[model samples]
Target: MSEDPDLFSAISSQNQTLSTISPERLTSDQATFELERLATLIRHYDRLYHDQDSPAISDGEYDALVLRNRLIEQNFPNLTRPDSPSKRIGTRATSRLPKIAHSIAMLSLDNGFSDKDVGDFLDRIRRFLRLGAQEPVALTVEPKIDGLSCSLRYEKGRLTQAVTRGDGIIGEDVTPNVRVINDIPETLAGSTWPEVVEIRGEVYMTKAAFSDLNQRQSEENGKLFANPRNAAAGSLRQLDPNITARRSLRFLAHGWGEISDFPADTQYGMMQAIKSYGLPVSDLLLCCHSLDEMLQHYHKIEAHRADMDFDIDGVVYKIDRLDWQSRLGFSARAPRFALAHKFPAEKAQTTLLDIDIQVGRTGVLTPVAKLEAVTVGGVVVTSATLHNADEIKRLAVRPGDRVLIQRAGDVIPQIVENLTPEVNREDWHFPSTCPVCHSLAKREEGESAWRCTGGLICPAQRVERLRHFVSRTAFDIEGLGLTHIESFFADKLIVTPADIFRLHKRRDTLINREGWAEVSVNNLLAAIENRRVISLDRFLYALGIRHIGVVTARDFARQYHEWDAFSKMIGQLKSMRNILLPSLIETEEKYRKRVAKELTGFVNIPNIGNKIIQSLIAFFSESHNQSVVDDLLLEIEVKSVHFQQQSSPLAGEVIVFTGSLETLSREEAKRQAETLGAKVAASVSRKTSFVVCGKAAGSKLSKAEALSIPVIDEMKWQKIVKNNGHISVKTE
Candidate 1:
């Protein structure tokens, strides 16, 4: 028995014809040979650029080879194949994501860093296909945006869904958030339109916007983003679409994912088709008929990368002919189709000047290193997160140590490796007490953290708790912003949860407050009134109790079935404390020793976990804490769970999306689905039952096909609801 030689025979046949072509019209064999040659050349360059982050030749030179191959293939169209080098965009996405085979396989391009590299590439094609020097190599060059890669799908001339370039095989569906971008049209306008089209490009935040966003984060004591690329990635990956919508992000389509009945024979023509579809495409795309012309364009882009509004790592070159692209096959990861010639790392070295500690809402102390100004990837780096006391000690970094800081993933600036010599120095001891409140700080055994035990009594902790309680994730209390909370705290109108109830009584005082206008006071008061009654889960979460998170609170509410049961357990712990072993009462200079002994006993309760019990016992044992809890309970009433016992459509199901969608905003849609009982997830696999697809539905759609998941559409969804009796049929 012999191995199947179909693929090898195919390549050998193409190679024979590729060896003979000159300037005259190509025979069918020459066209096929040229296409395969382009694929092989492009795949090699793709690895050189994407994986090694190096290029052997200028992008323009590589583009010329692709263009030449494309021209030949145009004359011989029947030889086109699916894995061609001319049809795709961008590298296959990272493997950490669920794999998504593209709706269309993204291809790679050949590269040429010098005339030699360019000449060699052509020589191989010429020798393989029997071509001569008179046959000119042609190419196209374009800027490669450095940001999150994604695809947008349109159906029936309407913008429907967007997906990240997850693993080249599958991507997380993120249509809802992408829809909010003003630059991303909701509907493709034109009577004559492609039935389905997938536009692929990078989602980028402009440098100016990144700076402004980081500045705002800095002023508000929020986590400062490392760079625009990271900011864009983080913002788009958010589970909440509202966050994405508020970031003022933008999108530009560079190529297509899936095109139906596309009337294009070349890459240049395809770009024109994409633009005509009402999508934003770059105006700087250049067509070069010679390798030298392509190289010229590549140099021009490299010289002007920083001046552009968006960040670009390198230049992208593509083969122009659609037929040639098909003939060119693929490799395992990136396409054998296109290449991205990356610029050298924008990494520079600088000295560590000072280390600063900041307290977060969670009471975790973060250590930051102030750095001497240095340029990293075209952005100025002045500071980086040292992470914690342990991290600093591990590096033995002190003030004035020269450090090599690399922006991790070109986003967060981190001390990659200490470049300075270690000197005999004092150990950077973790703080023993909260810096702001002077309360004891303790690092729990086996945990990589030191936290302030001051809890809510610490003003920093207090302000943070107040902020969390009002944030969109928790109670979503309108009008109770940071300014209002700070003002109320200063005016003594609010100290604990109970003070919120008494705010109305101080209307005159609030109106007369320093920063409050009449309208402000009224609005604040009205917001409080509206939130007087809240859902059991939300109200429980708003308590800001130690060790009690939203998930834990929901669990407790479900188990205990009422706030009284939950509160009664807390009260019982207090009662038990009064009867503690006399040995535990020996509070001396060695207070932690005494506490640790008692902490062991606190963890013995069946349902009371160690973390919860520790936080509860700590809070209750502290002087004036019981009163705060008592006052809060007196001020507000927590509503009982109303819908827990009711039957719901999505009550226990876990759902995830992997493709583009069209029907509703993803955010509102997710919430609607969740409200009905579905648990929305980010990836797709065997666990997924239904996959809703829109235009350009990528690898996940295929995965759904593989897994035999029921794939449906917006109309099918309506019918499902109607059949399930979740919706009523209305008379037209």
Candidate 2:
């Protein structure tokens, strides 16, 4: 974890070896060990960057770790650990607010860091739909706001619930907090609105607001948040709604979630509808028909990012047509039809004053660089993370050496490179022991980070884990803030997560404690009691496993459906790992095959991989982790996931559209096709049941003719889509 020279050398050498070594050169044990180490390191970094919002590495450096992990996994799929960082999305929902399950999951978008990446994303859509290169794919481009995501559910045109995008599937209810934001409409303007609709958008603080808020915090001796995104999240997640109301929080609608009925069929049209309903929508939204136009819009947005009142990290490009969106479907974590193209990282040069090692809640040691003050992207950079020993060695940075610092998407600053390295100095070495507790800190084989052997005994780790346990996606007990958790932990009033459920037993003592008023204590107890009957997903997420995030936890919940069943299966897997079958009962080859077969089932779970399977098996294999699960199960009920599938007429049919329609727009035509129980594809393929060719039908028409697929004109298409003879068409 030291930013010292010796650690850097170790990392540099290790990375070089990894890069040069072929998959065939590695033994099964070597690959397995490397995969485990990479998984651990990546998971630790993911938590630091995503959950805590205090990233210790640059995006490029992080991407390298992910790339390394991926390469290893690709080479040795069977060696992949169950807890591999690749299987998860953003960090677990670890906030203080109560968790609310989203009616429709609010997924993240895959990133397109370059023009080629964006082009590939579009090309992917084309390939998935069997579309020709020349076919037009209308896309809606908008600024990807670098702010907190919020989902606003409106019933009868009145805003009822507002939730943060905690983990996509579930979020923390912030209805009261958001109700006071001026940008959000209290009621829709139109009478002809859906019975239920969830408007999804970003909750942000203007640059002015962020500056003003930070100034006030400094004056009041309050903790200053890192950036506008952090400040906005803190303000919106305030326990007291009045506090949130006082903050200058703004919201801008971009998309939606669950709806009783959609007002429009295209993304642009939907945005217009949302704006007409009195919701604030971004004026930067543009509809682009070609990849060049999308890239142009992206560059324009990037140029304006610094000038805008609010912060934006990138430009989002989504398939314009709703029917296309539905047909394109989604990946485990993101929509396949949408992408986020991030702005380039901004860099500046500064002297490296010193290197500091900081240990996180999970015991992973991180190296930070103390830098001479330098301006970067309008902010004065004093310090940046070295990431690990390897990053330091990679840059060959030393005290007094000039180094390049980068800030991208307003994320944590990182030392990108060393500008000066000729000055002679002794090599710095990372400590072999934990600085705080004097516990043995060891870097496992093939790992980048050094971790303290101390578990619950380490105060920092203990406090952090407890905080995560009560986070919004976990137990979500109100009033048990980090401050309270620290105080309770220090006093030995609580230790393990199970102790949270037993807090009511400490009522008499807690009531008499300092800063514990009767009303507050009662409310805290009530919050605890309210969450006694929790869902299986939340319960699993509360455990703070290395890589079991909200989405993965939901996957587990859905797959197993019940606590007893999951626990039993995990136990069986654990037994299988520990026991060795006799050759008489079953041949060694057969036993190995059986083990692989069982693991494949776990790995095949959508989004679940060998890394996660290994992590799960390793966790269950441990007596203490199992005990924690057993104890937690005794304290609460784990509800099963009940899926209610909606039936649609376009359930199985795949239809394609070509040319311009006279009566309906391309998007509307696709929507009508979907409404009539058809999947509107981008091109005519063997799977296509019918192709609607309108005026000036192009390559698709020819392809459909060649394939002998049924081809119909606009009038015939309208006749087939109408439910009861006449079609209801909206004029442009």
Candidate 3:
């Protein structure tokens, strides 16, 4: 990314840790932060991979982040962001190319890195079909070619258009560029084909072709590609067909989209039909009868992956019958019937040069290991995450020692093993003071992070908070970014959020600054002014409170419609926390520990946990934080949230959904509940009005029964929703 790892990478390792933890074990604040951090990092990496055609991380490393994000969203559905990666395929297509909207959207496949993940995938498929464990499902196993996804539209057996898989729905039209590729035919070989069909496949460059092209570019002083995949993508998106013709780009048909008629019932048969129609198909593809055979094929392809002319990242397995795929259907993000079994991260050995500490938004000091420049997969590696002091100590890594590093799935690469750990040398010293602010950095009990106690006074923390305030999901002020925030903060021109709004007044001063012109300064001011009126939830989230992320902020906003009401509850919470009479303090402390008890009615909201309460209290209770909020409030208006419906039975009720929802996807259920003015919570509690049960209903079901909360089955929920679009509000 955008912010670079130096600013946000420190927070990334914690995100990985959070990803591994069960959602139930995570505090509301922790989940919120992890989700927010993951969303940011994923978007950043996606832009790097899609928009720039320069991937900083390997495919395995990238897939790992997406998988973690998927898991986190699965657990905390309500907390999912508007900018969630699950909502789209890739970054937006470049403006240079003409755009095309696919007749049927191009979707991604869910990935599996291990045998257990693949086994679980099979189990889920069997569970969905209500098949016995012994059932042998036919699957089409093929190499997942590491290339740009392309869709070629054929009309009357002739190639009419070609499109890139840009953000799934819309794509860049690369018809002219694709026509230059020798592997892609101008017309179908056979007359018997659908009048209108979109053949989907991968656009790739062979290893030999890529090497020759790079050598030619090197001699010509032209832009060199990082790898074959990038070379293929860059070549295929060229505006001029002649430029594309000069590059040896190749194609392989895997599937079809928007077909006028079905040519075959099975995926294997469909591939054969596509190949018969003049498109090339992979010879390595095999029709497997069971999961074991499918896995064996995956290893078979991986073992000889180096021998392949083009790059293949993984093996993709899809249900054989097209009818089975249709029945299995699509999940919120990807096709449930398919999964890509990815290769593990590539490993390499390098000497640890030095350990550098970077402070995060929350003041946690994260150690990054500097390494002698090395290549893992296609990306160059110079640094890897040391994670925390405990990890560094566990590895006993010292400068100049050789370490085995693995390409990480998360944001930062990680040191897997210190190869020279036993070598006699002085141990690398872990700093006890903040590197930037020189404040005391203390490691809390039972915590991995060593945090600086400098609080708001720390320049690093202040800059980061300001950066978050203008983040895409927050105030979302256009034209203002991390670099601008850093520059303005360093110059003391924008020390706070209030200062950002006042930038218009500093137009002359800003115009005089380096890299800023009068037009740019004016544009920045215009963007800031546009955000003068923001939604209550966005404004609350922008405050950078410990636990109050977008979802939690929305929860609090729904609990109290206006900022005035929210502030009143904050005052009440402060009062409860500040009771100092010696005898009453002991009694009050024990009473205040109850999360379900209404200190203010806001505390009793379902899914609102004790940590959330503590964070809100701790945030507003601080004089500096309150002062900042007061200053920010003076510069903007916080708009109240609106609910469209109020008469539905679920209206304003906290409903908990458990297990696998077949009739309604988890996202669909939450959308309908919210549309009916209901709150969808992740867990069951005394405050939960009802629990909607689906197949394989879990502990939440038992908890709801124990609390005597109303339990509505999937059919009941669907019936209630289908009846005149709503049902009367009721508990019984």
Candidate 4:
């Protein structure tokens, strides 16, 4: 059987470079030979781990091989091939289950947050179907179980094998371990059954099992698992089935993937049919007639979250009609017919025992709420983040106030809402002094949060700043984590951002430091050395400047191609504030316009606002801040980015847009193509193919391409979406 075109298409479009690679042209004989050998080895490993669930090599060793291949491919881009095994997510396919490639890629479902988000999903479905408000519909609402996703295959009315959901299409065979599951029947009740049925569900650990596992770990003096979700992931990922069999893993059939035939025409019917085959389907599952009913069902599930035997992160609602499900289809990574509504995390009520302020890496003082011990979401909660002093005042939460705490998706717990008594109020005031350096705290104009006057000298901020510098989103300095950064800060081996660049010079000093060994220090230094040339956007953000997030940094980089230009602009802004004070108070419009003109030269990129401008001014005005910049400049060199204009097949085309593109969202489609060396204009012009229409595609499609841009639908757009990050379409 041939590999599904949709699967390969998505893979190729996602990784255009990989699909286009030719082994013959990669190198002069010797290099090509090695590349082929390495590729073969990597693919074999992928199959071994992904398909068989048995890995011969450790993760570290595997990463080393992949990194080597990446380096080789980077240097010899011409020789690189798209089909290289390095692109696979998990273990490769095994021989079990007849290795049936999916007809449709078993895409994961997209997660939604609040009721509004769920409403939006329903709206999309309604618009897609051109349905009226009175139109009848039904939804299959099931618990979004937190577990290892696995695909179970049944053929000739018998349970054939089980496969791990590896990269959606291909999966690791966990047949041996799956066979032990008593609830999973070996044969169907009735003789008549589909030729093939791939049952998809989550394999999880119950609350009881999770508690026992943690207790055992505690008794052995081993590290306690953070949560049940992580515990389940760790257990299922074991290379040996014996290890898996020992773990009290439970499976719950939530849905089906590939089905040759079924007596039911709706999803709920098929689910019932599967349950008749003696599979363990939870009774909590509900069938709702409308979005409102679905939400109501979700609320009931959320109320009983703590009491549930198994852990569930959210509720999954699928279109009940199978025909509609097929028509609604899926995007590359997720389905369009269904959505997961995540519950507002379980909130624990606790007393605000104390309040403390901690200095961030950027010298921002964040207030921490020390709470009396309480359990939230099955995890013990003791503290929550207040965010800032304003939040504390807003909540009116004092030392004795009872607060509700919530944790989501393994993030830090936060005080969700205040339960402070108005009559017995103890109003908390914002601190005037910096907690770390004892410097005067001041809130810059147009900004709400107070910041420490001290810049890099603030000890608390140093470790955070250093961590941010090495973070994947920032400089991406490998081998440097929070522990290494904290250690270096305590030893005074690194204090400022500049120290990171200079640490390589004192290799012996770092190596000889307490708790520091030869190999670890060397690896850290190597990571630092590799990050010699920082990107413009990352450098801007790594400066720990206020009001600068990823998008802001990217905009700053786009506007000012050179670091010198940006630095000069910062200096000029500082000078202008002092020199042009009289001119600033003219008229609101005049003042804003004049300031904007000067600002545009330095910051005319998208999304730059008044709040950001104020922070930039405050940063440049401080002499200490200037000193840090000078110190950093001496040790670190900012690499100049040469923006090249590349010709793309979709470039310079006026693409007409319409509808809700299921594959790539409208904004995402525009952003993707624009990023991929293509010009994304506001409206369709003469040179547009690619109407790229979605459901309810509007007027633009009718407006003929004045310049000849070809219009395409979501399906065709999906063909180009995969390999190219910018080609990604947004699904609501």
Model 2 CA deviation exceeding 4 Å by range = 1-113, 125-345, 444-447, 581-596, 599-609, 639-641, 646-732
Best by lDDT: 3
Model 4 lDDT tens row, 1-732: 223222222222211111112222222222232343355556656565544444555432344345445555555443354444444444434443334455445566665667998999898887666567889889899888977778788998888877777767766566777776655677876765688887888888888898999898899897576566556655666667686676688889988877888769988888888888777887988889987798899999998988998888778999999888876665445677898887664567889998877665555565777889997645566666676666677788888887887664212466777786588544788899997779889986654457787666777666656765665546766666566667778878778777888897889887787777999888878877888788787788666666565556666777787899888878777676566443534987787676766665455454576557767887777787777778888866787665555656554444556777665446556656665556555556554545677787566766644444466677767666555534433322
Q: In model 4, which range of ten residues has the least summed lDDT?
A: 11-20
**Lowest-scoring 10 consecutive residues by lDDT in candidate 1?**
1-10
User: Number of backbone collisions per candidate, in order?
Assistant: 37, 14, 0, 40
> What does the lDDT read for residue 647 in candidate 3?
73
TM-score of each: 0.46, 0.53, 0.83, 0.67
Model 3, residue 32: C-alpha shift (Å) = 5.5
C-alpha lDDT of all candidate models, in order: 0.62, 0.73, 0.80, 0.66
Q: For residues 1-732, write the lDDT of model 3, one tens digit per residue.
A: 234442354345444344433344334444566667777777777777876788876676678678767777777776788778777678777658988898988987888888888889888777767676787899999999989999999999999999998878888999998998999999998888999989999999999999999999999999999889998888888879999999989999999899999889999999999999989999988999987888888889999988998898888999998887886777556898899888888889999998888776677777888889998866788888777788889899988988998764445568888788375567888999999899999987656678889989899888877877886668977777667777888889999889888888888999999998988878778878999999988889888887677788888888788999989988887786566233544565666554325443446665677667777888888898988999988999999986455776566678888988776467666766676677888888787888888989979998988988888877778776667336542423
Off by over 4 Å in 3: 1-78, 177-182, 186-192, 212-223, 421-429, 504-508, 514-517, 577-602, 643-732
lDDT of 3 at 473: 68
Q: Who wins the TM-score comparison?
A: 3
